[model samples]
Target: MTSQEEIKVVLLACGSFNPITNMHLRMFELARDHLEDSGKYRVVKGIISPVGDRYEKEGLIDASHRLKMARLAIQNSDWITVDEWECQQPEWVETAQVVRHHYEELISSENNNDDVDTVRVTPQLKLLCGADVLESFGVPNLWKPEDIEEIVGRYGVACITRCGGNPEKVINQSDVLYKHSKNIHVIREWVTNEVSATHMRRSLRRRQSVRYLLPDAVVNYIEENDLYSEESEQKNADVILAPQRYTCTN
Candidate 1:
């Protein structure tokens, strides 16, 4: 039984977490540190986003395995917990809807005993995203023009900086977003690491050492499952080298 005063929550921290990495842990620590230093809201938990059917990428591992890996990686962190609701959904859903629903559920649960209760409900939600996603905000098909209102109007977002993109582009585009809803906020911290899941996968297939790239648990999981074998690596290399054959669709 947790006390109401000890239930402060912040930052939804959503992501595929395909294979959790040191970067992910670093971001969590940074967010918590920021909240503490600012002396504002006390962050009580970090929510992990499990993969759903809506992912556009091809050749993803099973969600169960991914979820297991995420759980293993965060096992030592008492403040972080895995949220499997996204992966468990029976149908595909939009990102905006997911955000709204999660907050709504939190609010509803908090007020569940309102009939004769003296409990005050306090629910705050923040969306965590990478800079790449922020740059692509104009194109999140999941978010309709109005859905943006529901999101920024109701919750705050934490944006982490990533490479290969300009922050100004994201800010300028966000002007239009602000017109719709003003609750959106961005974090300017740059993660500095060039690690990405695609590169990790490629490295694994090539039998290259991925030390210090991904979390130890994820590396172990990949090894135990025999993921990304040498044959696949060779095939990928061949495809990259032999690539220029475009045909006329007419």
Candidate 2:
């Protein structure tokens, strides 16, 4: 058996993260825990990259706000990091490119390392998504075939099955994905709250309490910044006065 130090694994999650619900963070945690429990892999880092504004997903806020919210949500965790490169892109970038972008960075850093340990192996990069996103792969034109091949075939994918998501059926349906099926890891979520960003937004719109549904700091950040509220647009003054101010400083 290989020693823990010999192998490294990192998960890159790309999504709208419009307000970043608790489930978004749980996917990373669940994936990492599953990988670590396998004994053959050592989880290293996790990255959260929100989609750019150009994608124009309905109810999605500016990338900067989403990015800040993501950062705030992960502040307490030492291993997770937020990458802004995706949101910074001038045009709408596909999800595969987002995964590759960070994967290449990890490779580049490893190449530049002057103190390489002979026993340490190269890190493994995998795209992290919920089952819904994985199911969407079969949705016509929802994801480009080339992009899907590049992501799952190359870096691979780690998914957490959400309510009503059937990874097995989807894999059985897609020839491209099934070809690299060995690279895929799908875990059924157990303990975490199954919250959705869309649902959270709707709750906010209805002026309902979302406390504890998400990271407290993130909830506060959402409320303090007036994001997702029905009248949030009317609160632009505060949003502008301190657009970057996040509720959690930890």
Candidate 3:
């Protein structure tokens, strides 16, 4: 594999991004640096696909807000872009399908290009996630085995190591993960960050400052919209912000 030319890869991160944090954006750089520094692959793109509103997860804001925040968060970025396809869907879409959709979109665009002389190597699309998401695959009935196989075995995954999370151990325990272990790139974070959307919401609910944890634009947007407050919760009383099964610190 080392003898072959550098492979072009796009990292796709699908999440609830109820409110994207700095750590969420940091994952892309960390994964890109690791993949590029290895001299094996050139990461051409980074995508953040916020889950649809139908995904009734705790502390989740409206899909419009998440999508807007995502776009604002990556406004300064050169390669990373927010894809609203997932968030626009009428129902919740799984992560595996999200990866496949982007993979096909990239391929379709390349095929339609008029430049015939340009080399058309199919870029590999891999799901980018944190260790907390990786660990959830082990929970009983949480994920289907076939979906896991399709995501890990087919598209591949670039997992960033989170604090107190052992990605390697989780990979070894799961048969599906172990089978495609080579595809799973576990990136280590030298300077750990514990910022997460859940913790950020808690702070916001209390009317505390979230200046540094999120982008300035995002901070201002939250303040302007009055999101994640007790009144907002009361307004949408039907939507319960239940305790999340996974302690996502990403």
Top TM-score: which candidate number?
A: 3
Off by over 4 Å in 2: 4-6, 116-120, 231-250
Q: What is the lDDT of candidate 3?
A: 0.85
Top-down TM-score ranking = 3, 2, 1
lDDT of 3 by residue, 1-250 (tens): 5635899999999998879999999999999999999899999999999988766664567889999999999999999999999888886676777887998999998999899998888899999998877998898766767778888999899999966778889999999999999999999987978898878988999989999999999999999998887654454346542212222111
What is the alpha-carbon lDDT of model 2 when measured against the actual structure?
0.79
Clashing residue pairs in candidate 2, if any? none
Model 1 lDDT tens row, 23-99: 77777777667655555557877888766644423445567877888888888888888888888877544567678
Please report how far candidate 1 places residue 240 from its true position, in Å. Answer: 21
Measured with C-alpha atoms, the lDDT of residue 74 in candidate 3 is: 96
Task: Please state the error at residue 23 of candidate 2 in Å.
Answer: 1.2
RMSD of 2: 7.1
**lDDT of each prediction vs. the true structure?**
0.64, 0.79, 0.85
List candidate 1 segments past 4 Å from native.
1-7, 54-56, 112-119, 140-142, 162-169, 180-182, 229-250
TM-scores vs. true structure, each candidate: 0.78, 0.87, 0.91
